[model samples]
Target: MTVILLAGGLGSRMYPLTRIVPKPMVPLAGKPILEHIVDYLNTRGFKEIVIAARYLGEQIVRYFSNHPHAKPVLLDSKDTADAVRLLGNYIRDHFIVAMGDVICNADYSEIYGYHLSANPAATIALKQVENPLPYGVVYLDENMDVALFVEKPVSLEAYLLSLAYYRRRSTSAYENLVNAGIYVFNPYVLEVLERNPGLMDFGRHVFPYLVENGFKVKGYVLSHRVYWSDIGRIDTYKSVMWDLLDGKIAGIKPPATEVSPGVYIHPSSDVRGEIRPPVYIGREVRVKEGAVVGPYAVLEDGVVVEEGSRMVESIVWHGTIVGRDSVIYDSIVMNNVKISRETRVYSSIIGTRRIVSGELRNSIMEPVEVVSPYAQSA
Candidate 1:
């Protein structure tokens, strides 16, 4: 089956991070988020992948163009409608479509199988959310078919109550299922997309056209409760990390968290720590320590923990150094950051190649330190 990934947005919500990088290029765990999706698709036995791109689309082009399994389509068009129209020209058959920003936990195989068998003009993946007001909500029929779609509503209680009612389909007044940004569709859906070029939304535009025209659009309830999140803001980004740290999501077996008895290390890393499973080291990374590493901390690759430094709940990036007796707590240190001895850094993000050789600093990167947080602090 052909899987289409929409990677066109400018990702305005993911500022600071997205300022220098595209959303999909933003790193998660250790690698870029886009790479993870590709791996997910490959694992589910899907080979043909297409990415729709814009806004520094070259990054997307540059990435997949080099990869073996990635087949990309660059769309330097206006809004969502034009992008979809462009894709329709190529995806003339049934295909799977997903948003580049929506990170998911469920496998594509089951979703694809259901779409094939159901033979609906479109199959919409549904997930019940506690807060549905911020997103598009699709109302389903008793037969688990889509009846109507709603964009973000201004009314709050009506929205929440709608979701509450929709969640319990058997006794509810209506069946409300928020789209999980996953869709499966036949070529006919593409025709709708092309004709309604002015309607720039799938939920607000094409799907409603299906309903108004009496097309068979089915809604499949997602069975697995997986870790699904959109990494668009700093808070959401923090939430993703916290979720990974807590092992809340199943499908994403984070690297291999084997922090020794008193250690806390990430799974994909190698560490020689004083304490034994509580240590968190990131992918292809290493840590050598007479240093007290982590009861809880993350070290990205090429990070060095020099002798006798203390760190907890802190994140250090590739090539950063934690100098001897340098105490870092609840902070993020970027790549190539060098901390001189006996300095104390807490609750801060130090930029890359920044030199810190002072007494104590709170949430501040050194100025002549030559490290700018935008570039230095990855």
Candidate 2:
């Protein structure tokens, strides 16, 4: 089957990071999330894959080209709908369209089967989440046919009241499912999209239009316990990373090879520091004496943690040098960064090639050459 991965949007939520690479190209457990997505699709019997990429899309194109797996078609487009439209002749009779940032382990085959059995214009994968306020909720009838769709209700009370207007049970909002950002579409649906050129989005326009026009659109509720995470923002990105470290996200396993209980150190690295459990030290990493790497820390290739430094619940990317006596906690240090001695960092994001030294709490340091206390004071 053909799968269209919508990866075009500039990941504004993940700013400085996306400034370096696209959202899909963001590393999760040392592998680009887009690579993970491709692996997931490949296993599901998807022969042909198409990536809809625009902002910093060249990176994605280069990454896959160099790696050489499915060799997916990279369609440069501004919108998802336009991307689909651009695939004029390539559009198959049945296909899947999914968001690139979503890390979900749903059975695509089952959803495809459900679509074929129900014979609807479209079948959207739905998941039951506790708080559906942030997402577009899908109301399904007894037969699993979508009854009403509410796009991100303001509050729980508002959602309940909206349900009450349609005579649907108030409790339905709590028990109802939300769109999982996964869709199965037929060729006819493309014609509908072509006719409705004004319809920019699938959630805000196409699905609503289909529902209004009495088009049979079904909801496939994922029955099994599946791991699903929308890694859109900084918090969610960290969450996915933590989950990968903890081995929470199914299907995609972390590249952590533990030499001791909860302590993973790459063979190529030289570690002399006291490392606590649940730590990952990548290749060519150097943790000097008197340094404490711990609790939950991930140091990528070429990372150097100097003496007297302490890191906890932090992720240090490639070529970063943690200077002596630096304390990094609950932060993400990107590629080629330098943290000067005695610097204290907490809950911050140090971008690529940055040089930070000072007491920074909840700070976001971009890719600057130097960001020291003296530099800022002067």
Best by lDDT: 2
Question: How far off is residue 196 in model 2, in Å?
Answer: 1.8
Off by over 4 Å in 1: 154-176, 245-248, 254-270, 275-280, 283-286, 334-378
Best by TM-score: 2
**Angstrom error at residue 90, model 1:** 3.9
Give, for candidate 1, the lowest lDDT window spanning 10 residues: 369-378
Instruction: Kindly list the per-residue Cα lDDT of model 1 for residues 1-378, writing each as its tens digit.
Output: 678888887888765445445677665555567777877777778788888888767767766786677787788767665676787656657898888877787867888889889899989888877766667787777787887666666787776676566555543244445788888988777777666667676777777877889899988777647657777775676566656556665655445454444333555556664642344576556556677766557676667777777887776766677778778887767667788988888777666567887765556553233322224232
Against the hidden reference, what TM-scores do the models get? 0.80, 0.89
Cα lDDT tens digits, model 2, 36-92, are: 888877877776777777777766666666444444456766477777877767776
Q: What C-alpha RMSD separates each model from the true structure?
A: 4.6, 4.9
Model 2: residues with Cα > 4 Å off, grouped in runs: 72-76, 153-160, 163-174, 260-264, 369-378
